[model samples]
Each structure stands twice: as C-alpha cells, then as structure tokens.
Target: MKIAFIGHDLKFLNDAIEFFEHSPNISVKIDKWEGHEIKDEQASLEIVEWADILFCEWGLGNVVWYQKHKKPHQKLIVRMHRFEMNTIYPSQFDYHKIDKIIAISPYVYEEFHRVASIPREKMTVVYNGVQTEKFEKVKSSKAKYNIGIIGIVPKLKRLDRAIEIFEELYRRNNKYQLYIKGKHPKEFGWVWNNQAEREFYEEVFRKIENSPFKKNVHFEGWGDVTSWLKKVGYVLSVSDYESFHMAPIEGMASGAFPVVLKREGVNVVFPKDYIFETIEDAINFISENDFSTNNNLKTFVKENYSLTNMCNQIMDIFLEK
Candidate 1:
C-alpha cells in the first residue's frame, strides 16, 4: 500500500510514518507545505495521485486542497488538532470528499462535529501515543524539586500561570526550580509581530526576571526532551486548552509525576490526581513530595498510550474497507 502524509508541520507524524516505513508491504512518503502555502503544486499533485491513502496531519489548508483535487478512488483521512477548530479551515472542509476524520481526543471530535457539522459516523478519536522506551526513567537527586514545561508558544500555553505555581512552590521550598523547553516567542516572527502576543510574552519575561526565584527559572530552549525529562521530577501542563497534551504523558513515561491544570476535557485524558483546579492546588500538589508513584505513572502510559498501540490502530484504519 502506498501512503502519503501531507501537512505544514509533520513533527507529530514521525512515529506513525516510521511505523509504516518499516512495513515491507507499505511505502510511505511525506510532502510538507512550505508554511501554509504549497510551494510546488506539481509535486503535491504527484503525491496525491501516487498514494492509495492520503493522511492529512492537521485539518488545515491541506484538507481543503486534497478535498478539491483527490481522485474518486483515493482515501482521504484528516487528523484534526485543537488549534484548527479556532480557525476558519474547519468550515472550509468538504465532508463528502473526506473518507474519515481522526480527532486526537474526544473533546476535539465533539467540537469538530458541533462547529463544522461533520457527521458523527465519519469521525473517530485516536489519542496521541508516546514512545515510552525512548523516555526511560532516569532521575537526579534534586529532580523531585524540578518542574518542567515543554512548550510556551502563542501565549495560550499559559507560561505565566506556570510561573505563578513555580513562585509559590519556590517560596515554600527554595529547591523548587523551573525548566522550560522549546523556543522563545522571539524566535517566531509571526508571534513577535502580533502586538498582543508580543506584550503577553514581554510581561511573562518581566514576571520571571522580577520574581524572587528569578535565578531558579531557566529557559533551556529546545533539545532532546527525553534527556531533559530526567532532570524534571514533575511535568506541568497549564495550557489554556489542549486537544491532547503529550508532554505530561511523556513525562509520566519518563517516571516524572505530572501536575496538569484542569482544562476542558483534560480529565478525559489524564488522571484526576495529576490534575489541579487552580495555581494554589498545583503548588500544593507538588509540595507534597510524593514520588513513589513514578513507576505506576510509567506503567500507565506504557499500557495505555504506547507507540505500538497507536500504530496498530492507525494501520487498521488504513486497511479497513
């Protein structure tokens, strides 16, 4: 079977692509749009024609393009993430042309159905899986005091809220520190250009610099998150919203306890004990120093959201008549 993965950002598609690539009966190819615009129309058209299945990673412009150009016999599968629902792209999809719609979580599935009027029978929820083996349990002595936030882009990630939790934790225990992974807003020209986004980040920076624990807060930038996870005893997901936040799951697989802010539908994805209702609740949870459940956390992710499970589920979709 020939499969083509199409998207502007293919980072989340890596494990699924690798799974198919290793199969002797299947061939895989990816065609990434240079940003949102298709730089090479002929190349995209060729891939669309060649593939037996077209997996559109995000329910973005690619879905709109594929819906218009795909052959009648070709199967088109679109995977919708949280951010896309907030945009105009979902309204533009021709549901009749789409064979299947994959939502990363139940919340996303319902949102797409309600917002875009996509038929319920055409949609299915597939939780994002983590490679548990890659993020093996390794912890430093002071790791129990270290908190990690994976991404902080577009301000919705709530880095400011993370600082608030971290501040209170550091007040009680000075050993508590924060390690942020991923790029700064300054790295993205689009984010830096928006006046509101610019001010949001500027204020976030100001808060960090002015805080009493200023020296403890560290922006490590982007690197191997698995390696960084070893130093993080607790992983935080304080996002305003998420389709399915993977960082906390990955942290769990790495044997780090997760302290998540309860966003809408987050309870459907994570355990209640790991989720907090407010900044004070998060601070209190981390202050408890209960690290004995690290093994249980790793087992939870391994059994529930492993890469092998995700690959098999997606492969089943590919082979389904």
Candidate 2:
C-alpha cells in the first residue's frame, strides 16, 4: 500500500509513520507544509497522485486541499486536534469525501459532531499515546517538590494559572519549584506579532518577575522533555481546555504524578484521582505527596496509552476497506 501523510506539523506522527514504514507491503511518504501554507504545491501534488491513501495529520488546509484533489479511488483520513476547532478549517471539510475523521479525545469527537454536524459513525476517538519506555522512571533528590508545565505559549495554555498553583505550593514548602519547558511567546512570530498576545505574555512575565517565588520558577526553554522529566515530581495541566493533554501522561510514564485541572474531557482521558477541581484542591493534592504511588502511575500509562496500542488501532483503520 502507498500512503502519503501531509501536515503543517508532523512531530506527533513519528511513531505511527515508523511503524507503517517497517510493515510489509506498505510504502510511506510524508509532505510537510510551511506552517499554514503549502511548502511546495508540485511536490505535494505528486505525492497525492502516487498514494493509494492520504492522511492529513491536522484538519487544516491540507485536508481541504486533499478532499478537492484526491482521486475517487484514494482514501483520505484527517486527524483533528483541539486548536483546529476554533479555526475556520473544520467547516471547510466535505464529510462525504473524508473516509475517516480521527479525534484525539472524546470531547473533540462530540464537538465536531455538534458544531460541524458530522455523522457519529464517521469519527473515531484515538487518544494521544506516549512512548512509555522512553520516559523511564527516574528522579532527582528535589524532584518531589518540583512542578513541571510543558508548552506555555498561546495564553490559552494557562501559564498564569500554573504560576498561581506554584505560588501556593511554594508558600507551604519553600523547597517547591516550577520547571517550565517550551518556547517563550517571543519565539513564536505569529503570537509576538499580535498586539493582544504580546501584551498578554508581557503581563505574565511581569507577574513572574514581581513575585516572591520568582527565583523558584525556572523557564528551562526548549529541550528534550523526557530527560527533564527526571527533575519534575508533578506534571501540571492547568489549561483552559485540551483534547488530550500528553504532558501529564509523559510525566506519569517518567514517575511524576499528574495534577490536572478539570477540563471538559479530561475525565475521559485521565483517572479522577489525577484531576483537580480548583486551585486549592490541586495544592492540597500535591502537598500530600505519596511518592510510592508513582509506580502505579507509570503502570497506568503503559497499559492504556502505550505507543504499540495506538499504532495497532491506527493500523487497523488503515487496512480497513
């Protein structure tokens, strides 16, 4: 089978792509877009023409383009993430032409069905999987008091909320610290260019600078998060919303307890014990640390969201008529 995967960002598709490439009777090719725009139309067109199946990694312009251009015999699958729902791209899809719509979480599936009126049978939920083996359980001496938040960009991630939680944790125990991983707002050209986004981040920076626990908060910037997870005892997901937040799962795989703020579909994605209803609830949970339960957390991730399980489910979809 000839498969072509197209997307603006292909990072999440790595494991699945590798799995397919090694499988018998399958050939894979990937075409990437330059951010939101098509990097090379001719190159993408050639891949589309050659493949028996086309997989759109994000429900972005690539999917819309593929829907209009693909031959009738070609099967097209598009994966939709949470951010795309807020954009105009989801409405542009011709549901009849799309062979399958893959939602990363149950919440996303319901939203697409309600907002876009897509048939329930047309969509399938495929929770985001983490490479459990890569994030081996290891920790520093001070890891028990450390909190980690991955991806703070695009204000909706709620970096402000994370800081608030960290501050309270610091008040109870001066040993507590926050280690943030990912790019700053200035690193993202689109965010930095927007006046509203620029001001929002400026305020976040100002709050951090003025806070007493400012020295305790560390922005580690972009790096291999798996290695950094060793220093993090708790992985925080205080986002306003999420389809399936992977940071906490990755943290769990690395023996870090996840303290997630309740989001629309978080309950479907994580155990109730890992979720927090309010700031005080999250602080109390972290304060009463039982590090011995870390093994159970790792087991949960391996059993439910392993890389092998995700690949098998996706492979079944690919081979389906």
Candidate 3:
C-alpha cells in the first residue's frame, strides 16, 4: 500500500510511519506543510497522484487540498484531532472524495457528524496513541507538591483557570507549585498573533505576574518531558475543549495522576474518576487522592493507547472497505 500522510504537525504521525514501513506491503511518505495553510498546490497534487491512500493528520485545509486534487481511485482519510470542528474547515471538506473520516475520540466524531452531516458508516473513532514504555520512570517522593500542565497552545486551553485553581491550592498549602512544559505565550508568536488571542494570553500572563505563588510557577519550553514527569505528582487538563488530548494520558503513562476538567467528550476519552466539573472539585480530589504509590495508570494507557495498537487500528481503517 502506498500512503501519503499530509499535515503541518507531523510529530504524532511519525510513529505510524515508522511502524507501517516495516510491513512488507506498505510504503509511507509524509508531506510536511509546516504552516496553518497548505500553500503548495503542485506538491499536494503530486502527492495525491502518487499515493493509493492519503491520510491527513488534521481535517484542516490540507484535506480540502486533497479533496480538490484527489483521483477517483484514491482513498482520502482525514483525522479530526481537535479545533477544526469549531472552524469552517468541516463545511469546506468535499465528502464526495473522502472515503472515511477518522476522529481521535467519539465526542469529536459525533460533533463532526452533526456539523458535516456525514453518514454514520463513513466515520470511525481512533484514540490518540501514546508511547507508554518511553515515559516509564521512578517518580521522586519530593514530586508530591508539583502540579504539571503539559500544553499551552492558546487562550482556549484556559491556563488562567488553571492558575486560579493553583492559587487556591497554594493558599491551603504553600508547598504546591505549577510546572508547565509547553510553549509559553511569551516565546510563541503565531498562535497569539491575533488581537483576541494576544489579549487572552496577556490576561493569563498578568494573572501569573500578580499571583502570590508566582515564584512557584515554573515554565519550561516544549521538549522531551519523560524525565520531568517523575517530579510531577499531578497533571492538569483545564482545557475548554479537546478532541483527544494526549497530554493527560501521557502524564498517566509517566505515573502522574491526571485531574481533567469536564470538557466536551472528555469523559468518553478519560476515566470518569479523573474528571471534575469544577475547580473546587478538582482541588478537593487532588487534596484527597494519594498519588505517591504506583497504580494501574500506566498499564491502562499501555493496553489501550499504545502506538502499536493505534497503528494496527489505522492500518485496518486504510485497508477496510
């Protein structure tokens, strides 16, 4: 099978390529656009012509490009990760050319179905894969007070809300601290280029600056967080929305208990016990829950969200009628 995977963010797709390439009958190629918009029409056309199957990581503009240029015999599959469901991209997608729609979570699939009016048989849900073995480590006892939030893309993630919860946690116990691992707003430009995003980011920054526990709040730019997770007792997901967020699961794989907010379809993606409807509930759960000992968190993710399992499922989607 000749496969072409197109997307701006190809990081997650790398594992799929690596695993699939070893299969004797399969050949994989990636066209990394590296931008929000797909500008090279010629390149997209060439890819569509070359591949038997085209898999787009996000149902963004790239899928639209494939929809325009795709051959009659070719199978086009686009994975809806998140964010795109809220945008105009779904409406722009040419479903006539798309054979199947892959949503990372059931919630995203339902939302996409409602918005696009795609038939039930045309879609399937695939959870985001995590390399659980890579993140396995012995957590330090001192990590008990460290609360971690992995990704901070834009205002929608609600970092300000996280800080508010952190503030309340610190009031009860000064030992608590927030450790953020992704791109800080001060360092990232493109996501916050718009005035509304800029204002939202600035508001979060202002809250961080004014907070009494400012010194305890640490920001480490995006990188390999496998080692760092050992020092994090709790991983926070306070996002307003997410399709199938890998951060919380990754944290769980690394032995950090997740305290996820009640986002749309989050309950479907994560264990219901880990979810909270409000900041107060999250705080109470964290205060009462003991994460010092080892549990089945890693085992659960390894069994369900492993890269090997994800690849097999994806390959089935590609090969199936």
Q: Stretches of candidate 2 above 4 Å error?
A: none
The candidate 2 region of ten consecutive residues with least summed lDDT is: 31-40
lDDT of each residue in 1-321, candidate 2, tens digit only: 899989988878787788788988999998888866566889988987799989999898898888889999999998888778777888888988999999988899998888877688889988777878788855898889999999987888998899889888898898999999999888999899999888988998899899899999999888788899988999999988888888888899999999999879899889899898898999999999786667798899989998888878877787788
Residues 133-193 of candidate 3 have per-residue lDDT tens digits of: 8888888886778899988877778888789889988998999989988887756677667
Q: Clashes in each model (backbone N, CA, C under 3 Å)?
A: 0, 0, 0
lDDT of 1 by residue, 1-321 (tens): 999999999888787788789988899889888865577889899997799999999988888888899998899999888788777888888888998999988999998888888789999988898878898855888899899999999799988898988888888989888999999899999999999999999998998888889999999889888899988999999988888989999999989988888888898899898888888888888898677657789889988898888888888887888
Model 3 TM-score, all chains together: 0.93
List the candidate numbers ranked by lDDT, top first: 1, 2, 3
TM-score order of candidates, top first:
1, 2, 3
For candidate 2, what is the lDDT? 0.87
Candidate 1 segments exceeding 4 Å error = none
